[model samples]
Target: MKKTIIVLLTQLVLGLACADTIQLETGSFVTITLPSGWSANLNTSRSNEKVYWINLISPEKNENAGKIALDRLKHGWAATEEKFIEHMSASIERLSASLKEQPVSLNELKTDNAIILYQVLVWEKIVSMITGAGLAEYKGVGVIHIRYNSGHTAMITVPIKTLDNSNELNEILNIAQNMQISMPLSENKEEESAQSSIQITQNEHGTVIGNPDISRVSLLLPSKNYKATPGALAIGRGDPGYFIGRDMVANVIMSGWFSPIYKFKYKTARDLWKKDTPKQAKNLEYLKIKEWDVMVHELEIPIKTQNTLQVTLRANLLEDGTWIDLRLSSMGIASQRADMRKALIDYINTLQVNVAEARGFHLKYTKQGVIINAPAETPGSLFIKTKSLLLQKRKTHIKTEFFLFQDSGEDIKVIAWLRPASDYHYANVKTLWDETRATLSGEGFTVIGDTDCQKTRNWDVMLYDLKTGDKRTRNVNMRASCVSGGIWVDVHFTTVDQRDSSFLRSKLLAYLKNFKVSDSHVE
Candidate 1:
């Protein structure tokens, strides 16, 4: 079985390199650039039964069929239109319990030798789902299951999976990229609600969106100020990273993107931001933003024959102890710089929690902050926002989402995430301070100054001033001690430029001295 799977994988890889177009085994051709080979593995149990799994199983074609075509998705599809839906439903459930019973659409394409039945089901997979046989990550999965037989021939099964992070945006892009039916696609798709009728639901996964069912973090924009990023997706795994709702209008654009910390992809949000910053914009300055201290860079790129300027801002925030790097991009010309900057600041300031409307969590942050212990209401219930004051202790409590912190009030406005000790790994205070500065410098933020002192034998204090703005200075204070088991209590503070650091210095020590870690478990 292993050998057989290897042979098939090798063939697929070769076919991908040799065949620009995909010729389905059923004798139909579809056009797409060559996809790399598939990943295959064989699993055998104690019994004689063996299962072979192939991943990315895209490249294939038959001697008769030139390449993969919608016309070839005609095997089991024709016989089991109803049964196919049942299977798709079951498969969706397997992907994530949060996914709704999304609507399924079926279309048929007739070719010379065979009739292809393609089932296009739009649903969300908040939690990523992986499958055997070369099918990879699927989030807002468009489970395209094709099955049909030419009456005299045996039935065929061709399943394709796509991972989409946003629903409406992705659905529209998917239709443009994949809807190749001879019939007018808009006519059939209109029978169902447009992608604009989007809905969001929370589950074990962090966030999810529907109307094509892909998982994403969403935020509401000021009606006239901004809109969802406008563009078209180009085939395959279109783009990576889950963007909430990025809006780009005319010359000015506001967008937000995030990277998960648990992936161990980066040390902190700052590190994540720095790593993502383009190489062209080096020597950027770190400044104090409304929510968190951010590193800002300005760059100019040529779009078509015209020149466009873009300013990128990056910051670090912790959600439920999960480290997340957040980014905001301003695009247009330097002439609109001041307008876009003010608008960007206003937009971030207005971000509030509106989950009911499928909006994102925008918490407010300031120099004077609180150390909150967000207790859970239920024993094992998962909470994204930090709120509960009562202690929640459970033997099996595991955090399923990032730790979210907002300003104190009913209308929670998020500014920053105070990452727990678990997210940061530092041997000592000096190492933490020095490494942080190195990282900031690498990300283009100039380390204005650094201070380290051992006031007492009990603990050591460290400070770094990353002041990029002419009006303010963003300072971070770290007090590390062996008592907390090599733990560092990092307090972020901002002060008006040229003001004596005396006030902020005292505030930092006070915040660190008076803070405590909560139950230390995810609610």
Candidate 2:
């Protein structure tokens, strides 16, 4: 599936980026310079004739204060300035009808290369019904139509009230004056499709092998023919995976993890393939081997040794989240075709996966409190010294203890919190989640996606995904309540790298699943 790009202008204003250029998933390029407290998301999934748009949001108070949109039209429009004005008028008419109020146009500017129009809408905003107070709001909108002679047609809408006092309006006008739009070259499209098919987000931790979506299982790749790069054994060996093939050098990366059922959804392999099978994929099919259902597909990926390599991917996501991903690729050469086929078969037949539970440490404090099976130390990874802290809410205090897991050079913390049973603030799981989300939000973290709540045998579990304002860091929190113990517990699994997010989250869930409330412990 094509992914949407959300870019924050704060990075540009903070000097982390010097006028960055972003490429949309639809093969269109966008270059914009904006001030802080603004963020943009590109959407190319419009229902009308492949219309591409960028939605801009400004910092809000009380409610969303500013909204701006810029869009590139694909077809059905005249180049004349009059036609553009008519389109704007019709759009305003629709908005007026939806709001049940008439808006007045304040100003207009027509130039050889662009057209700008300003409008104002007057409305009443409800402040407080208890105090019988309301305020009149004047919202101003600016529309800009750009005339590109190269057959590219586009329009931009901005919030006039927010930009009236700052230089930001001039900067936005500069973008309209100098914007350039073009379709990506054919070769670039193919490369992008190939990269999307693999769906691995590269990070600083060695070469990312296999796919993050199916991170559970591991494959016993042929080792004699492949050598591990220095210090990369902690994560995945080499970049991506090791090279294979006897007569012809081919690439292969295999990974799998054990679980109780499939990772996301899809009851069958065919169903999974139908859900996200890339457009460029070939020979898409499903297979079954005793207890495992396998989905297979092929794509042409660009490589250094050749213009393109035909890659075959075999995947099996089962046992809750347990999965296996095996990728084999051969450089496009007529002479290597036969050898590649034989090598692929050999690798598949010889593939041996040892489905075993991960090693972990059974940890507890004072014979009770929060008990969990923390993931044990593996090669190139270790747990640092445990730490403790206290958080205050009103007159209540919650004690927190945590262990930091460090792999290769990257690190993530696993925190466990102990709260009083009579805190009342967390009398139930729903209130627990509300308190947790509110606290995290106050600390500058935004909850991502939907927060989930489920009931276990002896505890109520709540899962949350959170990210920072810049979207660079992420935390997966699991909060649980013991049935009889006079304490509440939660674990925060935090990671800065996207590649490790899934792995760390799964580990946290494992801990939650094995959690126990000891009878000897009392709050």
Best by TM-score: 2
Off by over 4 Å in 1: 1-226, 229-241, 244-261, 303-305, 321-325, 334-343, 353-523
Candidate 1 on 443-465: residue-level lDDT in tens? 87776654755543344556555
TM-score on alpha carbons, each prediction: 0.30, 0.34
| Model 2 accuracy (lDDT, Cα) | 0.41
Candidate 2, poorest ten consecutive residues by summed lDDT: 387-396
Give a tens-digit lDDT track for model 2, residues 168-281: 455456555555443212223332222222222233432233332222233444444443322121122111212222222335544332221322344666665574555566
| Candidate RMSDs in order | 23.5, 21.9
What lDDT does model 1 reach? 0.34
**Alpha-carbon lDDT, every model:** 0.34, 0.41
